[model samples]
Every structure is written in C-alpha cells, then in structure tokens.
Target: MASSCIGKTWCSSARVGLSLSSCVASVAGKRNRFAALLQREQGGRKVSVSSSVRSQSDPIGGIQEGLVCKPSVVTGVPSELARSRRRAGRTSQYRFIMAQAASADGAAGVDSSATFPTVGFLGLGIMGEAMARNLVKAGYDVTVWNRTASKCASLATEGAKVGLLPRDVTEACDITFAMLADPTGALSVACGEHGAVKGLGPGKGYVDISTVDGVTAMKINEAVKATGGEFLEAPVSGSKKPAEDGTLIFMTAGDKALYERASPALDVMGKARFFLGEVGKGAAMKLVVNMVMGSMMASFSEGLALGDKIGLDANTLLEVISLGAINTPMYTLKGPAMVKGQYTPAFPLKHQQKDLRLALALGEEVVQPLPVAAAANEVYKLARAAGLGDADFSAVLETVKSHSRGSTSNDH
Candidate 1:
C-alpha cells in the first residue's frame, strides 16, 4: 500500500493483490512521519484533519461529501498475493486497505495495532442493535449499552463489549454513537446523571443518530460540546430493514471533522450520507422526510381502502400503483403485506406517529401550513388508538378501513 497526506486528508492507494496486514507491516517504520503529517501546524494551533475530502458536489447544497479512500490503480502482483485477493474478494480487500490507511493516519486515535477506532454505541433498540452489529462486523472495537441490559447479551455474544452505563461506554471509547428512540431518551442518555456526556473530553466525540427535534438536537450538541467533545446529529432515513441491511441514508449535521472521522463506520451502516451543515439541520431534514412518508402512507392506506370498497381488488390497485409514476419501495414492499392485513412492524406505527407529531410541531414553529400532514397525523393517532402502536406503520390501513365501515353503516 502507498499513502500520502493532502491538506489534512490522507489518501492511500493499494496494489490490487497486496494484503492490508502485509502493507501495514511494510510501512511500520513510517508511523512517525504519518503522525507528523497529521500534526502540521496552522498558526499556533494544530490543524484539524478531515478523514475525507469534499466531493465535486457541494455537501452544503445537500449532496453527500465523498468519503476517504479513493481507489488506486491496480498493479500485477506475485502469484501468492493474487491468490490471496481472489480468496478474500476485492471488496473486502479494498475495505481492509481503507481501514488500515485510516488507522495508520491516527486521525481518530486508533490503537497501536493500527486497526480501528474504539466505538461505543448506546441504546440497542431495534435500529440501534442492528447498527452496532454492522460496526462490529466491519472490525471496529465496539462497546454496547442499552437501558434494558438484557438487550446487550446478543451483541456480547457477537464479540462486542457490554457497558453497564452510557458513561462507561463513552469513557472507554474514542467515539460514542447514540440511537435512542426519541429526544427525551436521547437527552436522558447523554445528559442525565451518569450520562454519556459525563465521560467525554478532548479526543472523544459523541454522535446521536436518534430522531429528534432541532431544539432537542441543539441541546444535546451543547451538552456534548461543553464536555470538550465533538457532536454530530445524524438521524437516518430508513427503517428497521435498512438498519439491519446497512443501507440506511444518514442526514448528518454538526462537526465536519467528526463526520470525516466517523466516515468509515457510517459507510459500514449506511449506503449514503449527507452533511447538511450546523447542528439542527439533520434533525429537520429527517423530520421533513418522515413527515412526507407519514402523509404518503396515510394516503396510500386510504387509496387501498377506497379501492376495496368500490369492488376493486386491493392487490390489483397495488399492481397498478406499482406500474405508475408514483411507485416507491415503501409501497411495493408494504402494499401486499398491508392488503393481507399482516403488518409486521418494520417501522412501528407509534414511531411514525411520533415523527409526524414532531414534524407538525416543526412546521408550526416555522409558521408553515401543513394541512395534509395534519390530516395524516390524525390518521396515525387513530391507528395508535386502535392498539396498533406496536404494529408496522402500514397498519394505518386498518384505521382507513374502519373509517370506511363507519361511512358505510351511516348510509343505512
């Protein structure tokens, strides 16, 4: 592997067949120079290095900043290394190369092994557990904690160290990520007694990937920064399956340097990431996305109910919709299950309602009229009232069907 530091960003190129461990061993003596390159001074203070470079597209304009590890030209290698590459697969080799390069730069305080940053994850709920697992799978030294300690058992079995409290996780790790269910939970984990913030200091960073209001996110940012720790609010855009599959989209804001540092882990857990600038933008963007999704789900439920009432097969309606301009993965994935009255909770109805409530409040704060979203919020409330709170958000169809029944009976 060959590497260079450019403007606080480290770029590395690896020969196609070279093993990452062998490459790291080859450059073991150059650790001091690599460390010096990162410690370059600007004025009297040390310059903060970004682990990634800005893409040709602007991140401030909402495009994803390109991550580090630009691909290097592949060269022919010895037969043994070529066989190794073929055995390990190119994707794994490249990922290993990038991981090693990032570690060797020491921008994120990787250990002497030059392997991975110590990662702490708090809140192992449905989404959180899956995300933490992905990081562990990607070879990070991960510590996990959850409110219900039993939730940590599965991860412990998977080689993640379990923490007794949020502070313990933060104190022991270089970077801590929280994915609580709400702003309240987020605050409680980060700012409550013995919270994550209590363990933070210089060289430690906290990233909250929880769904929260801008105000709440800003509050967490303040608490984290007060501890001399960096903060990033990175609320994701996909639900349980995406979280499990590591294909979620991250809408991130606050602490650009930390974002760059967290890039490798983020890449492990998400397919795309957008740095939207400032502390609350990510929360706002996530709320807006969820608001749109809630409204769409409500409308789709009504459409299905209306079709069934008019003697059209719900499946047929779904098929027609799938073939149309408005087709989306949500509809394609949820429609058939919804038609069968099987809502298995990929994204729970209660959380959808919560996001809708938060989005409506955001609109109210900005004095923007969201009449459609208001209607959808009411529909979700009805679903929750019908004891479908724990069901998939697609269970909103039952409320739509219930409303249809009331209308039909009123005609009698």
Candidate 2:
C-alpha cells in the first residue's frame, strides 16, 4: 500500500488485485513515493528503492490529484525512517522529481499521503455555512467560497480558508460540497468558464446536497461525470435548525463506492443517511416526503380552520391533537408557531412549492395520481399567489382561511 500527498491533502492510488492494506501503508508514511525517490538518489543506491512512481490503480490507467497512492505492494514504513532520509545536494533526478511533486496537487494526477486533503465548500447560506462548520469541527481541512464573501467571514475565524471563486475552491480542495438554493445556483458555480467543472478531474469528488428535482440532478450528474469527477445527489430533509444541529437526514444516491468514501463527511453533517440507489432517488425521496408534508399541513389547516369556526380554542385543539393518534413531530413543531403567528422561514414557501412541483412532475412521469398531494400543491400555489412564497410553508393556512371565506376558487 502506498500513500501519496499533494500539498496537505492525502491521495492514495492502488494497483488492481492488491490488498487495500498495502495501499494504505504506501501512502501512510511521512516519506511519500516522491520523497522516497529523492532519498534513494542521496543514499547512493543501497536503499534498493521500489518503483518511485505513484501507483496507477484506477481502472482508467491514471490517478487524479489529491488522491493517495494505492501501491501495488503494501508494507509498513516508519515515520522516523522517512524523516531521517534527508540527503541534500546535486541529483538532477531529485530536482526533476521535486518539480513534479510541487505541481502534482495542482494537476489532475496522483497525490501524496503526508497531508489531509482540503475540502472546498460552496454556498455559505443557512445550510451551507452550517455544513461547512461541521466539516471544520470534525477536523477536515476546509476552504470556503460564497457569492457574498461576507458570508464566509464567520467561518474564516474557525480555521477555514476562504477563496474568491468556485475554481479556486476546486484548486484548493480534493472534494467540493455544494449546498446552493437550487439547480440554477448549483449549475452556476459548477459549470461554465470559471466554474468548478473546469478544475474537476479523476481525483476529485463533488457532492451536491441541494434540493433540486431528479431531472435537474441528473443533468448535474452528467455534467460532473463528463469532467471525470464523481458525483452524488444528496438532498436532505429538515431545515435550517436541523442543519445547525447536525441532524439533517440525507437521502443520498449515486455511486455506492463514492458514497462509502464520503460517509465520514456525511456522518458529520447529518444524523441519518439513506442511500436510495441511483442519482435521482435522493431527489425523488425528498420530493415525496415534502409532498406528504405539504399535503398534511394543508389537511391540518382545514381541520384547524373548521375547529376555529366551531369555537374551539386553537391551542387546546392543538393540545388535543397532540395527544391523539394523529400526533406527529411536525404538528408539535409548527402548532405553536402557527398559534403565535410566528411563521418565520425555517423551510421557505418557495422551496416547499418547488418540492411539490417536482413531486407532481414525478407523479406524472409514473402515471400515478396524487389527488391529495395535488390539492396541497394548489394550496401552496395559492400561498405563492398571495405573495407568501418567502414565508414558512405553514403560511398556507392563510390561503386556506381566505378560501374558506369564499374569496377564491380551488378549481384545478
């Protein structure tokens, strides 16, 4: 096993049919493949050095930058031994190799094992910033980039490096995580002239944790795959509070191998994870859950409105509902908020509306009818129509109330 390093990031490349333990060893020592090669030149040939090149274990014949070398042979080497091999002076081969090592992390090639790879986080909004903080707190070397550079100020003090552009992020980190507003926002930073895709290659991984539709996710997946980077769709449930608390549930889908590689990071950002098969499953699951939530909120609205007209105290009604078989955490969380008229955005109306819209499209694709979900979608549409798109989705009750007063049509 051989471990290589590019800058501070560790990259491991392993040859086929070799034990992974061996690859883990090659890249584990302080003296990386390049450093070992340099030492051999100064040791006057008694070192009997193995292949000085980074291993090409990838089936595609080459490894990418920031990936540790997975050596064909796996043997433990002591760090003290690596540190003691300092030979200074006149080997042209040593100079040539140092030049190669200097630019290895910058190019799309195999990496060294001496350092931890940097992680680049894009979007520092409510969710993005929290996710980045968790990564930093978990001990990942992190770099951040946000459209509003001011958004990154808080994280910079937490030992996070801030960069100016998405391309800079790619150049700095081995893996990049994106938590943007939607597909448009994700694509804006991921594709085009100065986007991340330009810097992505075989050694890079891009995880999109945004809530885009399955189709949009597929398009993004295609874009990332075309650039030789691994892509994963990891839409999440819960909102800003869950994100901050690190309890967001990830509905992930993509290459299972890549998912395994990222499980450590995902575990840091979320409490639970569900690998739902392909690229679209995570998006599909998010849409399904949101559709149910939207519809349930709509139903709860009607129930509460009727209870109101019948002279029931909304608070007591909520207490009763909370005790009954109909109780749900969603009810508990939103009931008091609704009762107090505190409809601040946790999950904004526009995003919920987007989820419903995507669910409706998915339903159409599968030829499945979702009348209740359809009805809920209509309520959200009405909420948006009422200029409440930026409010919490619970504000849909306003539309329900207005409709109850015979102010509008519910016809589809």
Candidate 3:
C-alpha cells in the first residue's frame, strides 16, 4: 500500500454563537448592526468583534433588516455545494442541524446560567443530522442550517428552531460545528460572499469535520484566522455506524487553545480525538489511512478470486482469513459479505474510489511508489464503470470474481 498527499490551492479568509449574553460579546456600530465574542475572556467579559477587519482595533456594526439567506446558508453551505460534498460513502450530521435552525430563532438563549453549549451546526445531512440528534438527546441547545429547506423537517419535530439563513445559525448559538461533505462545501458555507465567514468574529470558533485534503483545510484555517475566528480541521474516521454510536475517531489539527474550547463537544461526538498539529495534518492522516484501506480491499478481492479458482469453499476461505496474521477488523467485517455476495452499501463504491484517488494523488506528491494502490485504483475505476458506483465497496470482490473464468461459471 502507498501513502500520499493531495492538491494545490490559493488561500484566503471563515462560528457558533453562545446562549448567554455574557458568553457573547455585544457591540454596536452605526453602519453595521453586529457583534463578535472574544475567543478568550478579558476581565470576564465576552470579547467584542468586527468583520472585514484588517487590524485589531476595527469595529463591528449592525445587522441589516430583511436580508434573505439562501437555503444553503442554513445547511452549512449552499445547496449545490452541499450536494457536491456528498459523493457516496460520506454522511454528515446535516439533518440535526436542519431541525435546530428550522425556525427563525432558536429557543431564546436557553436560560444562560444553566444552558448547555448552544451549537450552531452548518450542514444538515445524514451524519450531521444524527449527530445533532444525539446532542439534542443529550440536552444541548443546537441551532441548524442546511442547503435545502426540506431536510430540516425531521429535526424540527424534535423542538429545534430552523434558521432563516446560515448566518442566523451562528447568531443563534455559542459554538458552531461544520459537518460538510467536502472542502468546497465547507468552504462555501464558511467563506462564500454571504457565507459564515462574513458572520464570524473573535470569540467564536469553527470546527470543520469534513474529509478534504490538507490544502483545503489550510485554506479554511487562513480564512478563519483572517476574520479573527479560531479554526480547526477535525476530520473523522469510521463510517456511519461509528458516527451514530458516537465512537468516531477524530484527527484534529489547529491551535491548542481552540482545541481546549472545542474538546467538550468533540468528546460528545467521538470516542477518540488526536490533536495532529497545524491545520492540514488531520486531513493528511485520513488520506494515508484510506490509501491502505483501498489497497487492502483490492488485495482481498484478488485473494478471494484466486481461492475460488482452486475450488476452495467460500466459507472456509473467509474463516481462514479471519484467523490469519493479516486479519484486520475491516476484513472481518466485510469479508463474509463478500463471500455471501451481499454488498449493501455501508460505504459506497464511488467513495472508496475517491479515497483511493486522493491517496494516489498524495503518493505522486511524495514520490512514493504505490504499484499496489495504483492497480487497485484501476479496479475501482472498473467497478465504477460497471455501474456499481453506489454499491458497497465490498463489491470490489464482484469485479474480481466475475472476471475470473471459474467464478463466472459458478455464478451461473
């Protein structure tokens, strides 16, 4: 298996609000009706902030009445960008976010002294919705936004108020978490012309929990820093089940101070969290892990096909693999399904291919030879061409099996 890094990018400048007015910084500007919370405490007062600020002394203004936010504003990004982020395997806590911000204003600053962290959720899809549900279930005050209006329905049933736009989500909560589908979508929501970037100021923090390459993460980091909002790239490993179980593992990289402030929320969503350093490392590490996974799946597919060529019992082959030194939890979980021809997608084929593509891209940058991964990438391509893009990645076995002379005969 070969490990690799992915693409290039130009950088630029990209919160959640708090429940308590004390947890929030209030400011009044003649031209701008706006406020920003300090990233840290100063004399026990929430730091006040401003946008489009070049120096430390810039002042924030007020909100304009009747500003219309696009549907994407509430869902973490615009609908088109959000759709792009959602390829196949990746799921987001987008749904929960939807319900929270379904109403114009979230439950009026839930009794500050006893209020839990008010969360501003950007992106309200499958995983995003589930995670938000858990937070609501845990009694956390959550505000949500999504690209589409319809997605907010489930969450609204849970007593969540939907936001009119993305900025509203930030204004309604203390801290905001972004569970977008990809870097573009995450960035779109955070830095678009009327995106979250425009809404953030100091004292607010943005956590990006999407699986994009390092370059994208760095771009986001720069944007957040420019606006005085702290940024962290905290991508996760493990698929939908792990997210639902709250046992996902976080690969985080950012300022240590921001990490401390975000840890409690991260802890609620994931079982393990690693502070990888800087902004891009977490994304970098995730690519490496997926590279190995792509290679492993390809190798297993070859092995299973070869075994069948010699008349080996499918059950026996799986059992033997499970007991061998090469045994891995991934194989154990997917192998039986491969043998049984059940490829109901836990992780989709197209997404597996995307990860492999990302891994190979990284390999090119690092000058690492990955003949195995390269070959696997081809196989994944074939799987995609065969119209199995939406199928489970375990379906990789089908390609090998169907192509082999003996296995094809057995299929009939």
Candidate 4:
C-alpha cells in the first residue's frame, strides 16, 4: 500500500501491492506508543489518540482509505517549531505524523500541509500598530486598517495587506483584533456602518483589545454574537513600550472557544493572558486595574513634588524609594525623566484620565466608594486643564509641582 498523511489526522492510501488491512492493524496496536512518543516530544503535553479506524475500499478508483489517527488539539508547542517552519518557508501546519509513520512502517510518503488562518487588525494607533507589526513578523497573514489610512502604510511596507475598511478586513480574515483608543472608537469600528460586525459570521472571531467600560464591551459582544460570530474582550495591561516589545498582559473574557482559537496570535502579541469569564468581566478588571494605577501615579507625583519642595534632590529621593519596600517599576521607569521635566507619552495622560473616569462610574454602579481613585481623577483633570493631557501620565508630576508652588506663594 502507498499511503500519505492528510490534514492533521487521517491517512489516505493508493492501492499498490502491500497488505493495507495488516498495516492498519499493526498501527492500531501501537496507538499507545504513538501517543507516548507525541507527549514526550511535546514536553509532557497530553496527547489523546482515537481508538477506532474506519476504512472504505473504493473498488472503482483502486484507492483505499488508510488508518485513521486523530489527536487532541495541542498548543504552546514552543516557538522553535514555528521558527523552523518559517525558516523552511512553509506556510502550513506542520505535524509529527509523517515522521512517526516513516519510523513505524518505513513507508515514506508526502504529507499534506494545512495553511495558517489569516488575521485582521483594526486601528493602527501606537498600540495597534506595534501589535500588528509583531503578528506580521511572526509569519501570520495579517491585514490592517485605520481611520487615518496613512497609519496603515508603515505596516503595509512590512508585508501586511491594507484593508479599505474594518468590514473589509474582517471579511477577509478568520480572526480580527481591534485596539482602538477609547470606547467610542471601539464601538464605532465594531458596530457602526461599514464596521467589523457587518462582515462577520460563523467561523469568524472578533477580539476587542481596547480599554472600555463593561457596558460598551457587552454591547460589542451582543453585536458580534448576533452575527453568528465569536467575541472576546481582551483589554491589555501595558503602555507603548510593552506593546512594542510584545510583552503586554492580556485580560480576556467572553467566548472560551474563541480564546482557544486566538491563543497563538495572542501569544505572539502578549507575554501573558488571563481568561476572566464572560464579556463584562474583562472590561471591569481592566477598569479596576487602571483605577489603582491612576491613584498610584497621583501618589507618586505627590511624593516627588514633596521631596523637591523639602530641600531634597528628586533623583536622590527616587534612589531612596528604589531601596524601600514601596518601590515599583512605574516609579523606577518614569521618575528620572519626570524629574528632568521630560514626559514623552507612553500611556497618554488623556487616556489614563479616561480610564479613571470609567472606573469611577463602574464603582458607582456597584455602589462601591472609590475616594482615592476619585481624588486621582481630579489630579488628572487638573493636569489636563494645564494642557498636559497629550503628555505621558507621569506628567502629573508637573501639576503637583505647580500646586505646591502656588501654596508656597500664598504662605509668603
């Protein structure tokens, strides 16, 4: 029998001379061995093999169906395999079946390759652009779109296909991810006219990685599910540098199956992911996290301002804080530049303020008091009023310093 592995599971045979039934019996007997080998090769990941092998003999075509070998879905199989696939210039799903078959029966045959799913990205802002670029670099077939249109040009030059509209990109890809700036942009791109929902149906998934309220996320989820498509709210926890470095932490919810389907892509874009259950949960978790962050930034700014006002060098204060128990990466990263009055936006002041506002509203809805976050929101508002809204959130230090100077003037 002349046989070849097809897809990820089955084997197809062209009748020639060997005993096909005997071969199937032998392979079936050694199914446990195959499973063990696969598990060992895959770093202890569970591998389940199907027991029954059904075959149909085609008398007219002289072709016989070979033994069936189906394995459970395996993921996180190390990046080395992916890198090898890329280096080999193969765009299909690589399986270990061919090698195993060759070793089992010494029947060397061609194995068919399965192509990777096409991915689509909407919005090309700082976060989205970096994320989409990483996907393209990872050998994914990526299509991108942006409202500005020009923003898509840079990614396009990096081998990403440009989409004319959100709908166009969704229609062309199996899974689509959106990283819009705020709730309004996220909703508009996902549910508005010429939006992603318009092009979605069964077998398509939409992952919203934008920061939004739970209500907005639920609305988007409803719209996506209404189209027989899958939705996952995957707001991230990181700023510009993390996005650029592909180390953003994903807080995901809604559509468990979609989460599984989108894991490989998410793995490419984020360092870690937490599947939080249902659509609103992810959004709520992100809001709470941002609320705490906003408050912390406010406190850090106040500390820096107080140290400067009390005859202390700001950098020296930073070093002292670094050695203390209260030290954090946020302070370590933004303290020096902030002390020198340089605040290039990594996470924009306006966006951080927006997140704080949304978080306060969420707290109100749940009848929970968030006084510290509310106070932080006021500081962010003051900074925004002082025209620091487009700067980094760390620029709130300037607002703190300005207030301290005003108090000193009044005291004099």
Give the clash count for each candidate.
0, 32, 56, 1
Q: Write the per-residue lDDT of candidate 2 for residues 335-391, one digit (tens) a residue.
A: 888867778888888888888888998999999998989888888998998999889
Clashing pairs in 4: 1-18
The alpha-carbon lDDT assigned to residue 4 of candidate 4 equals 30
lDDT of 3: 0.62
Each candidate: what lDDT?
Answer: 0.75, 0.68, 0.62, 0.74
User: Once model 2 is optimally superposed onto the true structure by TM-score, how far is the C-alpha of residue 384 displaced, in angstroms?
Assistant: 1.4
Clashing pairs in 1: none
TM-score of each: 0.78, 0.71, 0.69, 0.76
Q: Could you report the Cα RMSD, in angstroms, for every candidate shown?
A: 10.4, 13.1, 15.2, 10.9
lDDT order, best first, reads 1, 4, 2, 3
Question: Candidate 1: which stretches are off by over 4 Å?
Answer: 6-95, 98-114, 409-412
The 10 consecutive residues of candidate 1 with the worst lDDT sum are 72-81
Candidate 4: stretches off by over 4 Å: 1-113, 409-412
lDDT of 3 by residue, 16-37 (tens): 2222232122211211111111
Output the number of the TM-score-best candidate.
1
